[model samples]
Target: MARDSLIRHYAYLVRVVVGRLVPGGKSRLEVDDLVGSGIAGLIRAVDTYDPAREVKFETYATANIRGAVLEAIRNEDFLPRSIRDRLRAFDRASLATEVRIGRPATDHELANELGVTEEHVGRLRIAAVASRVGSLDDSTSGSEGDTLRFGDMVADPSVDLDRELQDNEVREALTNALGHLPERERTVVGLYYTENLTFLEIGRVLGISESRAYQLHGQALSRLRQRFRPMLMAA
Candidate 1:
């Protein structure tokens, strides 16, 4: 098929992907804003498309469309390095915890595992949201565990709404802990816990050496544990 025909067919799907990734956008940036990312992927796919490649266009095209979206998002000044670090840490811990438990890990369980307060765990979720960049063609997470495994947040059938509210209150407590952290501590702690960026990535963003990044993240976690442990212990 010609390039224009291919473009006409796939444009709508690409737009929807962008809309989902960036929930609150004003829509001034037309769906075509994501086209560049899609086009790049499509061009690559097309060049690589083998006559012997038994795969259909939809599979190939969807990837192209997602890639476009991710590319566009990366252009934005996205999440800070601290948040990224926390996200990585959360992902790593979740994977390991699941393996150990032989079941999915709860958000609360994860917070405890990382030695951070439950409030910071909520902040980690808020930061886990992806950017509007077209799909990167590569996944950041290797664990194919269910995305909805954070069952602590899911509504329970037997519990009344009031009880659910209480559960949310605990989640809110975790968020509050994150809010109370100093800006540097907040950033470093997230890097160390949620995003799980290696010290190298954290240092690159922080303008410090790899070892320095590790030092900062370690110290940040130590201080947070010290400050919050008393309150949690008392409570």
Candidate 2:
């Protein structure tokens, strides 16, 4: 089959796959970029796929497309230079502290060694997390295996680049909003969303009721959405 036909037929598959891979906040990899990568993977699949084989083309192409996109993400270090440097320093300090204590260092212990406040350490952890791009196969909440890919959520063919720029704005807004959350709410948000814990698990971790965990989670998201609403409207 010609590549063009394959692309037209399988384009929706790319979006489906990419949607699962998209994260909630600001991300360096856009849905369109992932779709483009999927196209490249599809073309490669077309060239190499064999009809005589029992394997379905969609299955074959999906893996190729996902692999291509993941490869692109893995090749890039999207974190800003200063944050990257700080994370590296943190790692070194952690290892040294752990070796000295014969145990894993607490965040505060590592913070003291690194000559920074515990709060600074916490911010660095969040910044490092915000900068990472995860694999498509990683399981997400709500939609079965589908992750948080927002390709379908913000579909504006006429303003893709503008939307992409807005993604950055949204990320900045989220980072700032997170800072304003009450300490417990912020911790709950981080544990439930960022760490992918269940509400029950989060409650257990925090020694609170599961319903309370749910409440904190809801409040955190409400605050974040409210904080980012202006940026979303402008975008």
Candidate 3:
């Protein structure tokens, strides 16, 4: 395909990937900026793609596009260091509280643990979710010291056949995990990921405050992360 034609035809892929990465307008970067970077990746993919490879062009191009968007975000360093530190402190306090109580910690409990108001905890929760967007590009060490990206593990429709079976297994495990979540947590996860709704929108739909929705999101992610630990370690 001519380069311009290829870009025009596949441009929607950029928006799709961007929506997944920055759902709910959570990121500091504008959607247009991210899309611009993704287009660069698509152009690069067109120039370098080898049709003889087993992978589909869409699969290959998606990876490039995602990488470009992430790189742009990293270069910008959108999250302030103070916020990152607070997020780490919040995670620690949350885990400690959960261990002591034998259940997920509530926002009030976390606030008391951290010596902050519940309102601050709410901001921290929002920051935590925002931080996760950049975390997609983070590298994970496998049992054998090989490196993998969190983004690569997320199931993509265009994944090559070699990864199809593994992706299926992951999806099955996720389905089972989702089944195990409490009704509200499950609903939050569904609306956030499946429906691509923001926490604010989810709050309106579920008739809860936005902070409450964020709390549920954090709790659900903690549960899902625990379930995925073994898979990540063995990867």
Candidate 4:
């Protein structure tokens, strides 16, 4: 197939793969930008394709396209180092608490363990969320005796809702928590996660500085964490 034909035919695959990785429709990258990056991957795959390996072109192309998209996302990570370190500390603390408890730890429990106030813990969680970028790719978690994976939820996709909604209790809790956020916080959440906009883009859209966008994101996450500690901790 000609390069142009290949691009046209497989272009949708890029959207599918990238869309899944950045689900919630809240990506800073536009669809056209992602597609263009995938096109670059497709061209590279075509030029270096190895037919002698007996590999299917579709499989090879899919890997290349997803990698290209993820690479582009990685290049755009702009969180400060201090924020990253803080996020890491919070993650570590949460993991430690979970290991000891064999279940999700409440904010109070985590606060006690970390020797911080509950408010501080909530702030840390929000900060962690602000600093991190979620991935649609598979991830493994859970206690040592029982491992769970984001991919495992798909064993019964119709019922599991991809593990995101598997726990009815958590889902309801999350919805309630989201509903209680301030209007601006809700908007930031929708724009950042649902629209996939970057902080700068979100700032521009909301007529705020980038720092303000970051603050709102953190504040929203903090508020949600305060209300949904059980659900958040379990996940």
Best by lDDT: 3
Ranking by lDDT: 3, 2, 4, 1
lDDT comparing candidate 2 with the true structure = 0.55
Question: What local lDDT score does residue 7 receive in model 3, on the 0 to 100 scale?
Answer: 86
lDDT, model 2, position 143: 24
Q: Tens-digit lDDT track for model 4 on 49-134?
A: 67775556776666566556545543454544454455445555654454345444666877887788877765654433322223
lDDT computed for candidate 4: 0.54
- Going through the candidates in order, what is the number of backbone clashes in each? 32, 3, 0, 7
lDDT at residue 223 of model 1 (Cα atoms):
51
Q: List the candidates' TM-scores in order.
A: 0.33, 0.38, 0.46, 0.37
Candidate 3 residues lying further than 4 Å off, grouped into runs, are 1-13, 30-37, 49-63, 66-154, 157-168, 194-207
Model 2: lDDT of residue 31: 56
**Which regions of candidate 1 are displaced past 4 Å?**
30-32, 80-235
In candidate 1, clashing pairs total 32
Lowest lDDT 10-residue stretch of candidate 2: 152-161
Q: Write the per-residue lDDT of candidate 3 for residues 60-115, one digit (tens) a residue.
A: 67767865665555455544555445555665576446445544466688789999
TM-score of 4: 0.37
